[model samples]
Target chain A: MLDSLLQFLITGVTVGSTYALVGLGFAIIYNASDVVNFAQGEFVMIGAMVAISLLGAGTPFPLALLLAVMATVAVGLVLEALAVEPARGAPVVTLVIITIGASILLRGVALLVWGKDFHAMPHFSGDAPLHLGSATLLPQNLWVMGGTAALVLAVRQFFRRTSAGKALLACSCNRTAAQLMGINVRRMMLLAYGLSAALGAVAGLLVAPITFTSYDSGVMLGLKGFSAAILGGMGNPMGAVAGGLLLGVLESLSAGLISSGYKDAIAFVVVLLVLFLRPSGLFGKGAVERA
Target chain B: MHMRKRFFGLILGAGVLAAGSSFAADPIRIGTFLTVTGPASFLGDPELRTLQMYVEELNARGGVLGRKLELVHYDTVGQAKEAVTFVKRLIQNDKVDVIVGGSSTGDTMAAIPEVEKAGIPLISLAGGVEIVEPVKKWVFKTPHTDRMAAIRIFEDMKKRGIRKFALISGDGGYDKSGRKQVLELAPSHGLEVVADESYGNKDTDMTTQLTKIRATDAQAILNFGFGAAPAIVTRNVRQLGITLPVYQSHGVGSKKFIEMAGEAAEGVRLPAAALVVAEQLADSDPQKKVLLDYKAKFQAKHGEVSTFGGHAYDGFFIAVEAIQRAGGTDPARVRDEIEKTRGFVGTAGVFHMSPQDHMGLSVDAFKMVEVRKGNWVIID
Candidate 1:
């Protein structure tokens, strides 16, 4: 019984870590740009598939990974400049619709290009099973969890210590004031969006070997990551990570302990119920005052 | 009278020439419609690959009936309405001699009326018995009927001394048909249906449904869903730590399931087509050799595993066999030859199609497989 419980925890924590990465991207983008960046999952998908294909084609894994991340960051900058900047000062609903539309467009593009097959990439660390007590975890799972933690800590440090990172935060807190103080809010938005997409891509590449991904995988993953963001705390970076990991782990545990049939329903219900109980989410920045 | 005779003679000559040209070198075009994209793609994507592989093999084994076999493909997105349109295009625009495909039963069911209108041979890969029921003259199937699977499930459960069972099925057409079939047959197998829980395609939760099911005094669970749906079921079954025997439909063989469900999927029983289970059988067995070869070849080419890809593999190879046997691409001749196909070793098993049994196999064609340590293990 204890062995199975440990097993569930391992499974949950592993997937939860991936969710954390996606949610972190959401939180960072929201913090700077005040846009949800609904197409975040596509970045993850691009990173994983592009990296895998490049690696498969004999490119060094590190080089492929770097290229995938950079590619998404570039896409993020372009999307912000072309789409978001043109719709500046638009209603939040408009931004939502446009980003959702962008999500659909990205999905269509991925389908057309990739030709609809789930690819297999080699595990980041290795394929050897790691035994923890009675629970066995794949080495790749550790990489995902470690990578997420390191990313979260690095971002936290960057916001506190780096001048540019501080400028990005200042823009998020008060764009008008930041602009008045010559913080260059538009550039800050570009940086934040770029970083967000890059993070998503990194997460995707990390988990590529463990989970199967195809062109159609992005929408559902984006939804789940977004749900984690909302559940964890929409604008709070740490909260997004916490919420995602929590959701992933809870989902695994539910499937482990109860009926696998109800895991999806169970996870969503918990999210909805949590929202009802605490609107700010487990770690969300409480209610925000509209500018 | 002389003018009339000359005109009649000219018309006859023209008809004979036209017929002769059609018989000469023009490859008989076969149209394939499948879910090459979207969420249901896991089912169709491999199917398309298998189809491509078989077509290549047939071409290599000497062009079918001394004419090249041409396959025109389309993506159905696994929807019935999409299938209807695709079938129309296949018949009217592509001018195909035969239409084969249907990874999803709903799509196949929708394509039937259009195929009947075209007066062409239609062989479906989807396993819903209703697809052939009130049987259409031109429509045949390569997959065993869902009714056959229902019987096998109940019989397997009964054999294991499971007198009580619960059902967790999606509200899809195939699921509904299979569930109804199980209800009809379970009683004969000395099993009582304790509960029937349902979910929709977009549903992200089945906790309430599963909770209700768990409350019942059932000895086993029969789950029917595709993609994340059944994976969710498998996880929930584990989370609840329900010790009941869990059986999932073969439709859940997507790449996403293992990643999502992980260890919770261990020990789940599935009514797998013989093609997949043959991997666990002894190497000395001829069927095992075929299954292993198909798997090895498919993995080498496609780099992933699919449960029902063998259906598509079987479909393409069987059609080629018929074309070869008929010695020509004449639609009627090929159709008759296909109907008479017997003891032909296929990826799935020896197919024995008759005038009545167009699918060429039954429930017995499937072997029960269990997920053991993250791999499939054949059980009897």
Candidate 2:
């Protein structure tokens, strides 16, 4: 029983680390532009698919991964220019609908381009099973956890230490005031989308090896990541990370102790209960005045 | 001697004319509806490839008794309703003389009434003994039925002295039917099923039911989910450290399952058709040659490992043989010829059909295999 708990933790955290990475993408984009880029998941899908195609085409793994991330960031920038920019000053509801529509378009395009099939990327690390006492850990899983933490820290430093990052942060805090103070809010928004998509793409590439991925896998991943964002309180990046990791760990624990059948439900239900008890989330930005 | 030569020439010319006249009127078209994309794409891709191969081979040999054969295909995306709609389109627009059904039993089941209404032979490439339950005369299956795999798993378990077992399945149509067969058939094979649990394909967690399975006194586990669910289930099972042997349904594809299972997939037994085992079994091993040829040709064409699509390939080629035997695409005659098909070497097995039985397989055709280093090692 104890070993199983540790096993679940390992599996769940590995999965959650990817989810948190994606959730951070969502939180970042939501914070910057308030567009709620529904196509966030599709960026991940594109990354995985591109990596797979490249790998199949015999491109080395690292090069293929790099290209996939760059390609996703490019796609994100294009999405901003084509979809988001034109819809500026549009109603938030319209923006939401448009982004959702964009998500559907992306899926359709993926299905057509990639064909409807699931792909399993070659594992990045060796598969030699590692046993620590009674529990076992996969080497790739360590990459997953470490990569996620590093990304979170990098995102923190990027926002705090960089000048352009500060401008973006100011925009998120007060878009009108930041613009009045001569911040290029529009470019910052574009940068946010690019960065967000890059994060999702990286997550997708990392997760693809462990889990079989299809054009449709993004829907579930996107939903879970979105839920993580909500659970962590939408605007807080750190909260999103914590929520994602927590969600992953919690789900695993329940699967260890309770039932896999209800693991998804258990995770979501716990989130709901948390919202009910503490609407600000475990570490969300404190309650705000209604507009 | 001169008179004899004239008579032989006369008969030859007459035969040529008859063949030419028949060709001018209508070519027999076989329309297929299957999940060409999505999780089940593996199923339809192989079936379609086999159908194409049969068509090419038949056309090259003499056009299925001097009439050209045409094939139409649709990607159903694994939705049952989509399959039915595609079948309808094939019947109405394409005027297909025969219907080759899809990769999924649910879609095939939903497509059956229309196929029967059109009175065309519907050769199914999916499992789910239910497709043949009502005994539609126009319908036939080339794959093994649920009874074969389910009972085989039980029989094999009993042989291994695993009297007590547990079953976990997806609540989807085929999985549900497969689960039912295990429940109804296991006891007869002397395996006692201690617990049964179900979940859906979209389900993210199967640990709850698996936890229940862990608590049971079952000597082994019988698994019946497909795609990601099975992969997740296997991982969860290992995570929970319930070391009982797991015997998976034949629905578990080799590449998909092993990858999904990761390390936990080691030592898991799954029922596979002779197609997946043909190379290991023998080159002159009849069915092995066909499957090997298929695997080679399929890879050459599609650039991927053959999965459950192998079964699909077998079903379709056998159907082509029927069309070839029938001498034309007459629906009634094709159905009759398909029913009379015997000793037809295919990817799955040497198929033999009778009027009452659609699936040409018996318990003898399946091979039990385990994943070792991402390869299938046949145990039985």
Candidate 3:
């Protein structure tokens, strides 16, 4: 029983790390701009698919991955400039809807380019399962967890230490005040989107070997990542990572211990409960009033 | 002036005669609605291509029943509502004599009532048993049902002396129906389902379920799902070091499954149509010639030969043969001839339709094949 519990944890953490990366992407964009980028999942898909196509063309693995992430960052920049920037100063809801439209457009374009086929990326490391006591885990799982941790740390440092990150935070807190302080708010927004897209691309690159990649695969992952972001208090990057891991663990344990059929239901129920009890999410600070 | 009037009258008379003669040789319309351009396009695109190619070929060889075949197809885009609308349009506007489409079971089932109401014979390409179980008078299907696939797997297990097995399925429509069939048929086959599990359609990982199955005392594992999920399950099964025999349904019969699952698909068994291993079949096998012929013709035009396309081949020929045997496009006579079909060897199997069994395929229609070195090999 204990061995199975450990096994479930391993599975949960592996799956959750991908969600954390995607959720972190959501958090980053949400912090920089109040518009929830529904297209964040498509960034993951584009990253993985571009890498697969490059590898199929006989490109080296590392270079293919690098180019793929860069391509996805370019796609994110294009999306912001074309779809989001044109609608600057629009209501956040409209911007969110625009991102949703952009996501659909991206999916359609991907379908036309790649067709409707699922692609598998060669594992970064060997596929031999690593044994831990009575439990087993794939080397890819370690890459996902480790990659997510490192990226999370890098993102946190960018926010806390870097002047540009501080400027972005200032924009998130109050755009007018940050602009008054000579911060180029638009460039900061662009940086946030680029960084978020890179994070999403890495998540896709890490998980593609395990889950396979397709044009429409982003739809569900994007929703789950959105849920993770909300569960982590919407705009807190670290909180989104924690929420992602927590949600993954809950799904895995419930699937292993209770019933696999109810796994998704139980996980979402917990998210709902968390939202009901604390509207700001598990890690969000409650709203403050200045009288 | 009189000479000019007489010449005009002659020209008008020739025009009338030409139009009347052409009307007598009007083509027989075969209307179809397939999911040719959507997520399920993988199934419907090939089906539409097969129908078009065969119709062209048949017309070149002096058409069915001395009348050229007109294939009028609508891309349903894998939507059932669109399928119903297209079926209605085919019946009302196109004025087709026979229908041979419906790429997925949902599309097929939604179009059934319309076909039955219009009294037109529909040979569906989808694989749900429910489409033909209650014996809809106007509906017949070409593909083997999910029930037959389950029975085939169970019989194979029973022959191997394996008793208890676990079933892992997806929550998709096809997967749910397949799981239900396995559970319903397990008892009669002297098999016991030790554990039952399911995952969402878009689930990225299934290790939790695989771990649960690993802890079980199951003698074998049967996964009934389509798309990329089964491949993931196969890889996870290998990753977790579970060596029990892994059996998949016909849903993963395509070469893409082997490509996706990689080395993990080796030795994995599934019951699929004979078209998958067409070149490997012995000369004495009855389906060898037909399978190879269709494969060559389709590959020359399209890129690959999918079982879904083979389903269309069977459905189109069945409609054509029934029209020929009926002596005309009389709806009732064509429906009767389709029902009386017996030993009509096609791509899927030797179809034998009857009043009670609209599908007209037994478990023998499926060939038990295993993935060997990234290619399909007939094992049973």
Stretch of 10 with least lDDT, candidate 1 chain B: B1-10
lDDT (CA) per prediction: 0.76, 0.78, 0.90
| Candidate 3: tens digits of C-alpha lDDT, residues A213-266 | 899999988998999999999889999999999989999999999999999999
Candidate 1 global Cα RMSD: 8.4
Q: With candidate 3 superimposed using the best TM-score fit, by how many Å does residue A41's alpha carbon deviate from the native?
A: 0.6
The reply for model 1, stretches above 4 Å from the true place, is A1-24, A43-166, A169-177, A198-215, A224-291, B1-23, B52-62, B169-184, B195-216, B228-243, B252-266, B279-307, B320-336, B371-375
List TM-score (chain A only) for every prediction: 0.97, 0.96, 0.98
In angstroms, how far off is B373's CA in candidate 3? 2.3
- Each prediction's RMSD over C-alphas, in Å, is 8.4, 7.2, 6.1
**Arrange candidates by DockQ, highest first: which order?**
3, 2, 1
Native-referenced Cα lDDT, model 2: 0.78
Prediction 1: B-chain TM-score:
0.84
In Å, residue A167's CA in model 2 sits off its true spot by 1.9
TM-score of each: 0.70, 0.84, 0.95
DockQ, computed on Cα atoms, for candidate 1: 0.09
Q: Give the per-residue Cα lDDT of candidate 2 at A200.
A: 91
User: After superposing candidate 2, which stretches have Cα over 4 Å from the reference?
Assistant: A1-12, A48-68, A101-118, A121-125, A128-134, A273-291, B1-22, B37-39, B72-75, B85-95, B166-176, B194-218, B228-244, B255-266, B305-330, B372-374
Each candidate: chain B TM-score: 0.84, 0.84, 0.92
Candidate 3 residue A31 Cα shift, in angstroms, is 0.5
